[model samples]
Every structure is written in C-alpha cells, then in structure tokens.
Target: MRKLYVIGIGAGDPDQVTMQAVKAMRRAEAFFVIGKGDQKRELVEVRTAILAEHVEGPARVIEIADPPRDRAPADYTEVVRDWHERRAELLEAAFDQVEGTGAILVWGDPALYDSTLRMVEHVLARGRSAFDYEVIPGVTSVAALAARHRMVLHRIGEPVHVTTGRRLREEGLGEGSTVVMLDGDCSFTEVPGDDVRIWWGAYLGMPDETLIEGPLREVEKEIVTRRAELRAAKGWIMDIYLLRAAEVRHAES
Candidate 1:
C-alpha cells in the first residue's frame, strides 16, 4: 500500500505555503507538479521553489504536462471532465512507479473550488486504490486578496458568494453577497456600477501584484487596463477579487 498527500502550495508566493504542507512535502518520496503549457510555466516554477526551499528528505520532483482540453467546442463542463480523466490517468501511472509517500502540489486550498480534490476522488473511484490520500490546506487567493485590499469579504450577517468569472458575466452579481475569484474576463463590468464596490487584485502575494478598489463603475476601466498590462508583461496572471454591495456594508454597520 502507498500513501499520497495532496498539498496546497497556495497562490504564487512560496511563503504562503502552510507549515503542514511543507512537512508533507519533506516526508514524501516523490513530488508531482502539473504544468499547464508554457504560458503558465510559472505555476510549476512556484512549486519547484517551495520544494527547493523546504523539502529536506530524499524526494524526486516530477513535472507532468496537463492534457489539453477540447475548448474549441466551448463546452466548458465537458471539456473539464475529459481533462480530469486524462489527468487522473497520468497521476495513476506516476503513483504506480513511485513507492512510499507520493505528493501532488495544488494551488490554493484544495477544498476551495479547486479540482485537485475531485481528481483524487476520481482516482479512488477506480477501486484499484492502495493509497491513503490526505489533503493539506493552504492560504487561498481569496484570503490573500481580501488581506491585500484590507476589506472584509462579507459584512455581518450578509452572505459571501464566491463564484467564477463566467457566472458573474452570465448572471450578474448577486444581492447581498461578496463575489470572489473572478478569473480574467473583466466580469466586474456586468454589475451595475452604482450598486457595488470592487476590491480587485492581480498576482496577489507576488511582486508584480496590482490592486484596485473603488466603486465598480469608477474602477472598472482601471482594473481592466492594469490587468491587461500585467498579463502582457508577465505572460500570465492569477487574480481574485471581492465585490460587495455598498448597502450590505452599511446595513452591517
């Protein structure tokens, strides 16, 4: 039987990695990092930096190219399912080759809208399981964004709704809830500017970080411009934000 630990390396910064995550990495026999093509090579590089800084045991780091998603059809859900299946297959093969503790470094906390947990579940569903899998949580980008902006994501008694950029664009911002994790797409423009305030941060916890906070209508253009500039400069960016209605804050007070 083999043991596997799925550790969250947090968003961008190596210092954001939890001590438990580091302990897991140091104990693992092999570390597996996912590479999402060249555009996101920094993702793998960040994980490598953490390993180099913390891992003390004799562990081998392995980098695997993530399978391509069929995005041409634009069926997001279907494409993601296919991609997860392919990833699970690759992970299973890697596990078979390595004995002792195997580790997979995940971005941000595993439980917070991350798919690594789901992929691990898929591996377990195969019923050929011989590994005791564990998940180590880390600081989420949402937390980092909130802290960087010095804003409370949710007001007292008001719910905070964490959603993706697509949902924000499609359904618009929800009433009395704070929306976090808008991955690109400038979805903030969909909200009625008069009603909401946006605290947006790109590359949170990194040196190239950019943060903009103001009424959505006022800062929408600024956020868009800055995001575009940062992305173009670095070839990539990972951003998250919190959108809260002005009324929600006043009501809580």
Candidate 2:
C-alpha cells in the first residue's frame, strides 16, 4: 500500500511550518495542493514557499481543483456532505495516479474546522484507495491571533467556545469567550452586545495581516470598514476574532 501524510502547514505563515511537517514533506514524493480559486492565490504561493524552503529532496506538487460548493444552501449539512463526496472522488483519483508517498497540505490544524481529514477518510471508506497516512499538527489561526495580540483567549479559567459565524449568529455568545471563524458576514456585528470587546485579526501571519482590538461598540465599524477594504484589496480574506463580555475590559481600564 502507498502512504499519505496529511500535514498541517499552519495559518498564513511559512515559518509556522513545524519540524515534523518538514520531515513529512521531505519524505513525500508528491503533495496534493487543494485549490481555493484564484482569489486565494496567495495561499497557494505560501505552500509553495514552504516546500521550497524545507524539502531537501525533490517533490512533485499536484494541484487539485476543489469541487464547487453551495454558498447559500437551505440545508448546510447535506450540501457539505455532497460536496465532500465529490472532493473524495477527486482525491481518490489523484491518489490512484501516484505510485509513491503522497501528501495533502492543510491550512491550520486538520482537527479544527478543516474538512480534509473527513474527505480522506471518505475516500478510504469507499475501498478504492489504500494508503497509510499520518497527521502532522501545526499552529492554528486561533493561536496566531492570540500570539499576535499578546492576549489570552478567555478570562481567568473560563472556557472558550470555538464556533463558526453561522453558529454564533444562531446560538449567541456562550459563557466565557467566543472565538469565531469561517465568518464572511462579520457576524460579530450581529452578536447583540454593546459591552463586549473584540480582538480581531485578518490575514494572520501574512504580510498584509491586520488586527483590531477595542470595545465592540467603539471598534465594530472600524473592523467592518477595514475588513471590507482588506478583502477588496486582496480579493480574498480569512479572519478570526475573539468575543466576550467587557468584564476583562472593565477590570483593565
């Protein structure tokens, strides 16, 4: 059986590539680069840079175009499931073509919001491709946000709820702090609280990185404007933010 290594290349920074990830990259004969369209061309360049800097031996890069996904579906879960099946088909076809060790470089940690691991497993479940694979964890964007801001994710011993923008809108903020990802709508604006503070970062770990931190009411408009400008300038943007009541703000101020 051939082997596959699903490595996390970290969020937006080539330096975030771990030693373990480097070793895996060196061992692989080919890497599968998932395409996120032309708007995110910078992300692909970042992966290429990582391979160039670390991989001592020769490695082949296989670009795989991602299947189309419904941007606004009434049934999100079902739509995602169908999209994953299509993606698994593509991955299986690519894996079948490769004879030696292959890899897939995922952004952030695979265990987080990413769907690569699930797609890999789906391909295996079909009994079409058999390959032993290992996971190499990397720094998540959440970590990058905290490190860049020099702030903790939550207040003293409080639990942090990591969720998506959709959920944050539907469920409201939980106890402690809320770290929101996959939010295209700047859902923080709809979070329904004036006393909250937001620590937001966009293009984290990249040259165009931007950060905003202040009371929600004071900085919400600024964040919205900056986010739109950044997105328009770059053609794409990925951002994450932490939201909680202004307890910490009150204490510090």
Q: What are the models' TM-scores?
A: 0.92, 0.96
lDDT of 1 by residue, 82-154 (tens): 7888888778777887878899999888889877877877788887667889989888888888788887777
- How many clashes (backbone N, Cα, C below 3 Å) per candidate? 0, 0
What are the per-residue Cα lDDT tens digits for candidate 2 across 1-253?
7999999988888999999999999889989999989988888889988898998755588888999999899999999999999999999998888998999999999999999999999999999788888999989999999999999887787999999999999999999999999999989898786889899999999999999999998999999999999999999999999998966544565
Residue 71, candidate 2: Cα error in Å is 1.1
CA shift of 103, model 2, Å: 0.8
Would you list the C-alpha lDDT of every candidate in the order shown? Answer: 0.81, 0.92
lDDT of 2 at 226: 94
Pick by lDDT: which candidate is best?
Answer: 2
lDDT of 1: 0.81
